[model samples]
Target chain A: MSNPKEHLYQKTAFDLVSGFKNKQWKAAEIAESFLNRALDTNKKLNSFICIPHESILDHATLLDEKRNSNEDLGSLACSPIAIKDILCTSGISTTCGSKILQNFTPYYDATVVEKLKDKDALIFGKTNLDEFAMGSSNENSFFGPVRNPWNLDCVAGGSSGGSAAAVAGQQCAASLGSDTGGSIRLPASFCGVVGVKPSYGRVSRFGLIAFASSLDQVGVFTKDVRDSALLLRIISGQDSKDSTSSSNFVPHFLDSLSIKKKWRIGLPKEYFQQGLDSEVRQALSQSISLLGKNKFEIEEVSLPHSDLSIAAYYLIATGEASSNLSRFDGVRYGYRASNPKNLNDLYKRTRSDGFGYEVKRRIMLGTFALSSGYYDAYYKKASQVRTLIIQDFQKAFEKVDLLLTPTAPFTAFKIGEKTKDPIQMYLTDIYTTAVNLAGLPALSMPCGFDSKKLPIGLQLIAPRFEEERMFQMAHYLEKEFHVQNSKHHIVL
Target chain B: MKFDIQTVERIAELSRLEFDAQEKEILLQDLSKILHYVEKLEAVDVEKIQPTYNIIESECFFREDQISVHLSNDSLFKNAPEVQEHFVQVPQMIASHE
Candidate 1:
């Protein structure tokens, strides 16, 4: 018999849950297998900010006791999963990688965390992220940037960078990330794993700390497409708290993957334009070519206002961020300035001291955009452009079943490479941001490696609530290219 | 369109944030560059396009009127920076003579 413990870190959550359900091995054994891997390598990658090492064993033993007693256990019993720091975990410090919330412990669980607990998944640790989910690279984290498992010098892309790196580093079997813009996909591409950002409102945003309320969606990083689909199935449903949460019935994502038909994939002409790294283009071409050979029809489609997406995304996200983040003024929770002279000093000093550089910059821009004289010029204009971008996608989707594009302009850049140039850093999400503007479901899966052996990500976007269709494409492409959920093969 | 120190100070005041001189100098340049980039949005003719305030088109649903213990007062105040008795203490919003 094959030793399940030997490959526990490499196994998918799907496999782990099945093993647990069948009572093939104890849940404590699988949890310890991953705990050992996380403890050994997490220091080097800086993937985990806080690991519930003792809690994992505690939860695992309880799960095992339940199994032994013949008690009912949820679908995912004792499968270890890492959570991004942005999510609220009861009694655990949920910092959102910002000093403002440095030591804040949430009194209640985020809806997603509560859901994972309901399924009996071992909520392993809180991974790092860009402070307030602001930066494109993980460098903006209060905790140090998460290093790409493939190359230590490069970044695991942000703001979901840590979750991506931890999974790629094999520190966890799977992880959850919140994607505002390309936080999940960029890092997933950088680290060579599967990242899925479901349709907006498909999942509850109740427990997630908001960045841009309209754009942010909780997603997952896993070894393969189905694991992502399985996790999505477990987490997505309407919640009483999140009024925006869709009342649409959740679909059976894994079973629905059996739909086999020729998918007419649309290739955006804008994405292949200048500035796309030649190597990335080659990897994208090869992945699409493999799909073409597999009987999937490929055609060139255009999103005319695509180039304008990044600018609109920044204006809209920052504007929303400025409003959403204004609640953090050292009153009810989080870091408070000592001995404030008055209320106004408390607000100014508390924010000035609490927020990091990039976060401050975004807040400044957002404040400027939303400011009276400039609102009609900056925020209003950007909102109008966002409408145009949405229309562009709407028009394109009418003719195509799915759209394929490069997830990022290039593979992981060096940690400090573009930190100085905020504009250059923002360009990393060039291809992926527009999808969020249109509020579509998209998946980023590994296609191939660059000359430097860094992984390239291929993004497949579907019309709203069409994640199953997108996953069908991702699964087929992953099989054909043999790149779905491949491990980073990087030694810490 | 011209992002200057006055503009920075104005926005910073509005944003309730303060930055040192060195940081302010950097913010001036960075904010100017970003605003310049956002200038491209002005070029796109969106005469009749309505701004998308919310992406998902769903009517807000009001829950049945109810009141219950969602969280205890102590748990809600667990992370408060300053709590007096059962209430969150904050700096005086208005100067008061006692």
Candidate 2:
């Protein structure tokens, strides 16, 4: 008989939990299967920065012991989950894909890490990311870019690329990612997985290394919609440590997944305009036609300020990034400069040597925007534009329960294709950045595949704090698309 | 929208970063292209709009002033580059009298 552990790595977290309850597989067996798969795939994918093999197996063995004692277990009991390196893990090296923190380890766990541990989820490893979560493609990482499972030559979309790639590659059951201006959704699209970016303040940011305090949010990357719901429920809630975390009730997201309703979905005309790939556009049209046949009212809507999102997002995001990233002075924690001539030399050289090219570019841009004479002309103007973008979404939601759009303009591109031109790279987030600007809950799920067999993603965005509505709609569409079984055919 | 070397240097100083001449030249080109793109924000009229610094509707919360367990000095200093008896070492700030 084939070893049951052989295919355990392919099972969903939800199915793994059920199997555990049925006494079919021990937690240690599941952990070993995933760990073996992860180690074997890391050489090609470069998805994980570090994989703690011994600790993961030990944690799973402890969980198996608990099961033997007939003790009640948490929802995620023994499922192997990967975390984006930006979040602090108490004893593990939490490098945010940068050389600066190569040897730095956090003294305490992030709130999300604590929550996952409480649910008995085995955090097998920390995934790679664009350095400081800056770029649109995974190419900006200091370690190396994560290779797309669908097409090895192409990039897995960024700053959360490794998180998305880990799930798509089946190295981990699910992974956590942080989204700031389409980081999670774009990668989800490229990697053909379900990614959710909850409304701002929906999840606590206590130990998530700050990229843009206003825009950064913790999210999840999963193989399917139901797995996304299960993971999202476990990691979301208010914490006294993060005052910005909403006290709004955290509903059982999985329980609400099957409640089908003929909700109105809006397709913003501007999102479907020029620059979108022909195949992606066709996929969106097919999905819309299917929705129409099912009696869901669909209509064209206008988000007039959509064009200004990239401009405003870069300004505001980089502005906050400049201020937030100033803490890495190299004295308290992380890499420190050697043989500094003076204090100024120490600070300058430490940052200059620590940060990568893209990071320095952003810091310079943000500093210039917030500099003494240019404050009103840049930062204030962008903030006003941000207000208008938020208003655009609010107005659209008045007519429809949710909005549907292509998650990205196209499928993944060749790794070095857009790396030369920063503008070309920034434009990759054109459709996805607006959702973060409005602080709305949005998710990207695979709706169809391109002519080349690369997955195409459809984004459904709902009003702030209304994640349940988004999940219900995505789950419905997921069933209709029947793309659930179309897993990535990457030969490990 | 073109940024010169001096302007790049000034901004880098403010950012507490340093770049060599080649890197600075690239930054100049990149910053110019990016800021020129961002210049589109100037066309929008914002006469009456309030700038949103944050979207959280609730007021700032204050925790109760009770003594609680917190990170110990040992743990806090564990990641410090140079630590000696609970003090983080750094470059000398004041000029010594000759």
lDDT of 2 at A441: 92
DockQ computed for model 1 against the true two-chain complex using alpha carbons: 0.83
Across residues A65-152, which tens digit of lDDT does each residue of candidate 1 receive? 9999999998778778999999999988899998999989998888999999999999999999999889888999888898999999
Once fitted onto the true fold, the runs of candidate 2 whose alpha carbons sit more than 4 angstroms away are A1-6, A483-488
Please, what are the lDDT tens digits per residue for candidate 2 over residues A15-94? 88888877899998899889889999888999999999989988998999999999988899888999999999999999
In the predicted model 1, the residue pairs found to clash are A223-A485
Model 2 TM-score (B-chain only): 0.91
lDDT of each: 0.90, 0.91
Docking class of 2: high
lDDT of 2 at B22: 93
lDDT per residue as tens, model 1, B1-98: 56789889999998999988888999999988988887888878888989987787888877877884489888888899999999889887787787
